[model samples]
Target chain A: MKIGYLGPKGTFSEEAVIKYTQGVENCEVVEFNTIPEVINCISNSLCEEAVIPIENSIEGSVNIAVDMLINDANGIMIKGEVIIPISHCLISDAPVEFKDVHCILSHQQAIAQCREYISKKFPNAEIKATDSTAQAVLGVKSKPGVVAIGPERAAVIYGMRIIDRDIQDVKENYTRFLVLSQKDGVVTGKDKTSIVFSVPNVPGSLYNALGVLANKKINMTKIESRPSRKKLGEYVFWVDIEGHREDEIVKSVLEELKGRTDFLKVLGSYPKFK
Target chain B: MKIGYLGPKGTFSEEAVIKYTQGVENCEVVEFNTIPEVINCISNSLCEEAVIPIENSIEGSVNIAVDMLINDANGIMIKGEVIIPISHCLISDAPVEFKDVHCILSHQQAIAQCREYISKKFPNAEIKATDSTAQAVLGVKSKPGVVAIGPERAAVIYGMRIIDRDIQDVKENYTRFLVLSQKDGVVTGKDKTSIVFSVPNVPGSLYNALGVLANKKINMTKIESRPSRKKLGEYVFWVDIEGHREDEIVKSVLEELKGRTDFLKVLGSYPKFK
Candidate 1:
């Protein structure tokens, strides 16, 4: 399978794609700068599959990913899942003792992830936000005594030294990535299915829609709402339930759900990773 | 009131802070690099209030804002609210047609907001993501034919000319900003309250908690769940209900909610903006 994902290289998305495509024959990675571009690349047959981060432990939801799936719900299905632990590194050119640095540069998310360490260790240093951790390293490549916090790969790619590592506030910080493809994904014995549905604009609508899953004892792992773009005051709910669509209960639940919701799209079902 | 917010200059946070402090006396805007810094600045008496963008219409929730509020529950309160319409502008060093651009640079959120326009208009151009839309302009400052999509003020600060205006996919795109301060905010007759609560690890816990508001006929504008750092298989909910905490029904609901939840934090209650 040829996999496409968001990157120029050295991004968390690239790492997820790599792990998801492990052991597949003739697996190649295609990188796009934007999430929609990655999805488009697959839709347009530039690649067979795409991997994108849907949520982080610290960041609630990746809205762009949600919007893209909702916007292009026609030919895609969730094929697999991967949750990677996030650990941020501080990279720089010259080794200045962490105290002498004046500005700390990294992605806004990285800046948020490491705020506690940055404030406590270097209270006076100005936090300079960058587009990406890799870009931040590039910005301070020529400057001495400045640090960029990002993935370890970015330091190697940008030829910056890791002055400090594991700076994120939460040690168990993980990002959940979804692998999407043009056709229905292969059903592994152990799997989870994700679907997006929108009920009619009335009271008890959502409750009735969720009732299908409840009747089957299908535990929902995640539930989120995104404004349905076509209309105001209407929303589509993205749901992850603990069963594959191929399962007997799941198939029945989906049938019931489809009847009740105005719009229902089965995004994908993939085996959950450990 | 002396106001501190996140900005170098020309950031959305600056605009929101200005809007919130419009009619206030002695409102001085002090810029900070990060949200935690804004909180710290306010906590240390450096500023009377700090404004931060807590949520965007396009992006679901600003998790950093929620996490910070939860972490500093006792030290801050929601003093005021401002809804600023987010309008993205295409900026470049030299005026040029959108089709001729080789690269389009912007902050991730800006890229997300202008997804439809960029995909439809400049399908072949490379989308380069930057830390801030301001930094994106700075990236292409010396390079011609490189354009950026960001706020108009960013173009002004970077000395870039506006190639196009109001390019966001939705005309009603707005970001909700919250004013945080040590003192309890002045409550206007018409107000809104925000709170965070974690339910008992039981099936009906969430339903019962939400029932308090539903029974009181209080409308909920927003509800989001964030993983609690304390334990595995647990989550905390951030809710924005449409009434002041001091209202009789709201107070009664809070009292009932306190008895049912594992823990509850009344982040703050402040006057809602139109």
Candidate 2:
């Protein structure tokens, strides 16, 4: 099996793929620079599977990933999922004190996750956003007065020293990563189905559509609205419900929802990460 | 009067403030590096008002701004809004051909907006993400082989040349920014009220909460779900509905909604951006 994930390496996405595969023999892992590229690789058959972060406890949905999975990647399905506990560390090139750091670099999401710490500790340090946390660590490796906030594994991979550990504002932060493939997973009793739909422009359109789930007594785990990309104020809602699509109740609810929505697309069914 | 916005000067946020203020005399416009800082300035009374992007046609919600407006900035309200049409340009230090560009620097959102253009024009160019589009333009000003994707104004502000114009994938892209103040706006007759709420963990909880709006014939302009920051499966829904909070119809709907929801917060009411 071949897997693709967002990386320069040492990223949570890479860690997710590794954790999902669990050191499977003969499994080859490839790295892409962006979330779309990872999905694109799977769409183009460059890789058989891909792992991408879909949501964070603190940051909510990864819009780029969700957007691409819905609009760009054709015939892609969520085969599995992994929830990785996230711990951000401040890593630098040397054993440097906090006062000596003049700049901090990381991905925007990582920077946001650690905002409270950065604001209080390095009030004057310049915050530079990079493409990925791993890229930030790579950039700090040759700079003495700069530090990067990323996974602790990044410091080991880049030969940098960990100046501080668990720097995220909320200590209970975790990212949910979805394993994508060309086909949907087979019926697993413990599974979750993800779907995207847009209701008609009517007063009770959303209420009617969601009523299908409420009527069937289906438990909705997540619901997010993203711009349909056509115009302002237009949105497509992504919903995660508890149960496999193969279940009779789930099938009937989706059937009713399809009729009420302007458009609907089932992204996939996958085993819920525990 | 004073206004704060996310800035290094040539960013869309700065443009938003300029467009919103529109030549108000003696108004001091201050710049903050991040969205939280911009909101923090308003919370700390460093600026009497602030402007921050709330949504994009392509990227959906600006999560940081939404999060702060909901959780951090106490007693702040949306006084007004500005809609800015976004068009990205390729900027470089010197007049350079597309083939000569080895690296492309931009904010992640800008890069994503122009993905189709960059991939077709500079297939092999390395893409670097920066904190802001203005910062990317600044980074490219001293580097000959690098280019940036940002507002056309950034090129002129940073003494750079525009290599290409209107490089965005979608020409219809626009960003909606909110003008925040300590007090909510008075009834403008044509207004929108934004609120965030969490329904109880039950099957029909969301349906019942949204029922408050549908029952009263209130039109919801937008609905987004963000992680409550408390748990993975939990979420807080942000809803934008027509009418000011002071309106009798809206007041009743909110009162009914408050009773149905576990927690609710009214961010503010403001005139609809024309």
Candidate 3:
């Protein structure tokens, strides 16, 4: 199997790909610069599968990923899911004292996850957002008195010294990634169905549509609304429910939802991330 | 009156301030570097009020603005809303044609909004993300063959030439900004009350809580779920309804919601944007 992931090689997404493919026979991984590229590789026949980050506990949904799936489903579907525990580290090119640090560099999301730590530990440090955390560690070689926040893997790969470990604001931070392929997985009995639905922006339209799930006593794991891109206040919702599309109850629920909602698309069914 | 805005001047937030404060006398508008700074100014008493962009038709909610408002209310309330039509322009330091542009610069959100245009016009141009759209325009001076996407106001203020006008992919783009102060606006016949509520991640918790609005026949203008920062799937939802908090139906709905939700915070009611 071949897998594509967002990378400079040392990102958490790379770690996700590694963790998900552990012990799998004959697995090869490719690194792409952006989530869209990582996802598009599957559709473009450049790769058979891809892993992309969908949501982070602290930062919330990765809007670009969700937006792409919502705006254009285009034969892509979720085959599985992975939950990676996020542990951000403070790394520098050389051993340095905390007070000596003058600039903090990392991807914007990594920087956001460590805001409180940054403000308290290095009150005077200037922040520079880089394209990726791995790039930050790599760039710090030429930039003195600069530290990067990212996975410890980046520090190891770049020959940088670890200044601090587990420095994220929320120690329990996690990111949920989706494994995308041309087709979804078969019913495993324990599965999740992700769907995108649209309703009018009127008062109870959403409430009415969600009733299809609530009435059947189906459990909804996640629900998020994105702009329909047509107008302000108009939205298309991405929802995850606790059942496979092949299940009888899930099938009828989707059928009922089609009538209640203006539009509905089933992204896929996948096993729960354990 | 003194007001704070996210600026180096020449941002859409600055334009929103100008438009909202039009016809007012003796208004001193100050520019801050970030959204947090703009919001913090109100609590620090550095400014009487601040104008900040809340949502855009293309980019959806400005997450930083929404997250700050959600995490900490701190006596700040929505005073009013202004809907500014967005029209991104291709700007250059010196007169340059489309083919001469070697790099594209702008804030991530602006770049995202104009992605289609950028990819089509400058397919090979390297993209650089700046702190703000205004900063992108300012930085273009020393960098040869670089262009920026931002409001025309930035081009005018920075003495840059407009290479192309209304270059955004979507022609009907708009951004909704909020006017924030210590207190919310007085009841207007056409008003919007923003409130946030939390429910357990378990099935039907959200469905039951939203029942309060549906039962009262209150029109909900917007609804979005943000991660609770505690766990994946757990969420706190921000909702906007069609009536002022002072209205009897709205008040009753809010009271019922408090009993039904794990946590509820009324973010205050304000006049709806025209």
In terms of TM-score, which candidate is strongest?
Answer: 3
lDDT minimum window of 10 residues, candidate 2 chain B: B123-132
In candidate 3, the residue pairs with backbone N, CA or C atoms under 3 Å apart (3 or more residues apart, or in different chains) clash, namely none
Using TM-score as the yardstick, the better of models 2 and 3 is 3
Shift in Å, residue B60, candidate 2: 1.7
Comparing 1 and 2 on DockQ, the stronger one? 2
lDDT of 2 at A204: 74
For residue B185, give model 3's deviation from the true position in Å: 0.8
TM-score of chain B of each: 0.87, 0.94, 0.95
Query: What docking grade does candidate 2 earn?
Result: medium
State how far residue B268 of model 1 sits from its true place (Å).
2.2
Instruction: Identify the leading candidate in terms of DockQ.
Output: 3
Question: Which lDDT tens digits does candidate 3 get at residues B1-274?
Answer: 9999989989998889999999999999999877788988988899998998888888788877888898875788888899999999888888887788988878767887887787678876766656578988887886679888888999999999898988877889999999888889999899999999898656788889989999988999999988888998888899999999999999999999988899999888999987
Ranking by DockQ: 3, 2, 1
Query: A1-274, model 1: which lDDT tens digit per residue?
Result: 6788877678788788778767877888987766777878777888888888787776556676778887784687778888888889888887778767887877666776676787788777656544456667776787887788888987888787888889888777887888888775667777888888887765456656766775667777777777665443356788788778888888998999989899898887888787
Off by over 4 Å in 3: A95-105, A116-131, A145-147, B96-104, B118-129
| Residue B79 in candidate 2, Cα distance off native in Å | 1.1
